[model samples]
Target: MSASMPQKRYYRQRAHSNPMADHTFDYPVCPEEMDWSQLYPHFFSPMDERHDRDPDKGKHGVEFADVGCGYGGLLVELSRLFPEKLILGLEIRVKVSDYVQDRIKSLRAAEPGHYQNIACLRSNAMKYLPNFFTKGQGMVYTMTDVEEVHLWMVKHFTEHPLFCQVAEEDLVNDIIISRLGTCTEEGKKVQRNGGKNFLAVFRRVEDECK
Candidate 1:
């Protein structure tokens, strides 16, 4: 995702949403105030109001997010492959979001650590990207499937010893510094006569480059 220098911008309000899976137009005034313990209680300790009130004490947060995640199929797939990465699915529909939450619970009960890193939440991702994700982790896409680019990236990342391919569980044995996204195509206005959405997956060495 290409981002221009930071500048103040105004966003229009979205007043309409599906009532079946209705959502409230609420968001954090700032990222620090957002409590992630509700999303992944097992991973982090309960919030201490004293610590939470301190501006310097931030709670544990998700490193990966699936915006507009429908039924959470992709997140379910990712849970097995990237078991150590904290992943969250954002769904606008209430019922759908609840289902994903339950799905994760069942999977965890069946096999404990298989799903400790996955979670889901109900929110309007298009409007509240910053509320749940930090600037470096939030990924928005503008292009569709580009196989040539994917192939080249895979080759480059694989050749680099710091990075490894994520094809099965236990993909990352060591503590990671940071990770990039899968081939993402959230924004593709003009498609190639007949093109499909894309997803990308890559991780870079931390402290290597900003």
Candidate 2:
């Protein structure tokens, strides 16, 4: 009699990948990298009641950002309103980014101060938000996804002790913050009349304090 041993078989599979993925664009880079003057040309004055701007300067600086700036229009207006605060616009599309870059160049040349406080960058906002924001370092401002940034703020602010110390009043006086498709119906109504054009408020609350 002879003893039999079990045989084991191994299988291997080829990798599934796309060649274009390697050269894909990363949106939402930091504010300092790109020049807004070469991206957005027209400046809309917020005080004129036609555009959007964070009127509370005593609360935050011009060091704000727009994570997914579609056309760089909002950033232009923001620059005019908060000339002291440095504004950053982050976009992913190569065509749009290039257009904004050129627009900003023309705007700056036409009116030097039109974009004096503005800049732009191209990167993925979701991945780089934490890196861009450092514990109450700057007055975080945006009109992008409310739920996304809200959660990010709550989490980031909790992790970073410096963020927890921000004053409520200071937050209130920070900016006229709002988002698209947030209150979709009401937002559209306002945008239609060119009155306010957006909804904004300052929310500086501690969700999980340590």
Candidate 3:
């Protein structure tokens, strides 16, 4: 059993077990029944303007997900860039998830019409990803929330049945429009320091998750 993240960050006696992850989760039977209104309030069609009460037709479901979102840096940036697209951050750590939620609330209060497309939830991504993302929901972002990315992290994601590893040829395949390894200042810093950040994208495929 993998032990919980310990006093390395802060002192806590949280019980975490890979096999016992489901004990911490209460998931929906289907994606449609999931309540997204609280997560993306700005996307909701005004009730005053609507004739019938069909939330599904009016609200846009989550298209982007960042598994293991730590401090929710990516969520904040993505929400600003794609205000129309709904994005979610799934963090398993209790205190970390609470911090992210508070972060979103502060951002929303500070600026009008911000962070409406983003929300953070506390849940084990390894165990409950299927609960949030429907089949073929789109690309799953796997940027490590940790300071140093790990080999185990890559292996965990690559092993999941829902995601098929996009090959290196796919980079030069001229099919995928949005490419990984962005050429920004952040990218340059990693490049200069010889950072071992593995660049890969995974497409969600149909699978029987037992």
Candidate 4:
């Protein structure tokens, strides 16, 4: 590895974190109050100057969120895949999140004008997803090696009124689906272990009541 690249050994953490634990996390009171410029500086302007400028000028919100993003493998890949879209990775582990942040910084330093659309934040997505994202926005992509977990996710998402599973035929054209199993660190580990991966993609649909 290059001297600038982050070493994975230095940022090791347990596989899972207790979401129920009382972890002190700073979150925005509301979505509008959140300052995204710090996360995606290339996409957004400073908060102070934003209000005075054109609403359409240098303003973009995170369109794709990788919840529990471990080591930011997907974020790096998606940066090259979707240079036009802003991607954010939310990881709860402090060391792991710091490693990802450093990794992005090194990559940006190594190659200028690249990897600016990607960023990582230390956040518990389960507790603060609503605080960062508004209702009826973005798609959810989930994959797991455990059959029980996969089934559980399928049951909950399929049962939800606002979320509908994307059809297999429809997923054929979406390049993001192809990377789910190949891009992430966990996915690479699963592949090395000769494990099977079950994937489900869901999109938000318009509510009839609205």
Candidate 3 residue spans exceeding 4 A from truth: 1-23, 45-59, 143-164, 167-194, 204-210
RMSD of each: 13.1, 19.3, 8.9, 2.9
Clashing pairs in 1: 181-200, 182-199, 182-200, 182-201, 183-199, 183-200
lDDT of 3: 0.61
Predictions ranked by lDDT, top down?
4, 3, 1, 2
Q: What lDDT score is found at residue 120 in candidate 1?
A: 82
Question: Candidates' TM-scores?
Answer: 0.53, 0.47, 0.63, 0.92
TM match of model 1 to true structure: 0.53
Candidate 4 achieves a global lDDT of 0.85
Give the top-scoring candidate (TM-score).
Answer: 4
**lDDT of candidate 4 over 1-210, digit per residue (tens):** 233898999999888888888787888988898888887676677788856244563355778899988999999999999887888899998889999999999998888778888999888898899999887777789999999999999999999988888877878888988898898888999999999899988877763221
Q: What local distance difference test score does each model get?
A: 0.56, 0.49, 0.61, 0.85
Candidate 2, residue 62: Cα displacement in angstroms equals 6.7
Estimate the TM-score for candidate 3: 0.63
TM-score, ranked from best to worst: 4, 3, 1, 2
What is the Å distance of residue 127 in model 1 from its true position? Answer: 1.7
Q: Which pairs, if any, clash in model 3?
A: none
- Residue 15 in candidate 1 has what lDDT? 22
lDDT of 2 at 71: 58
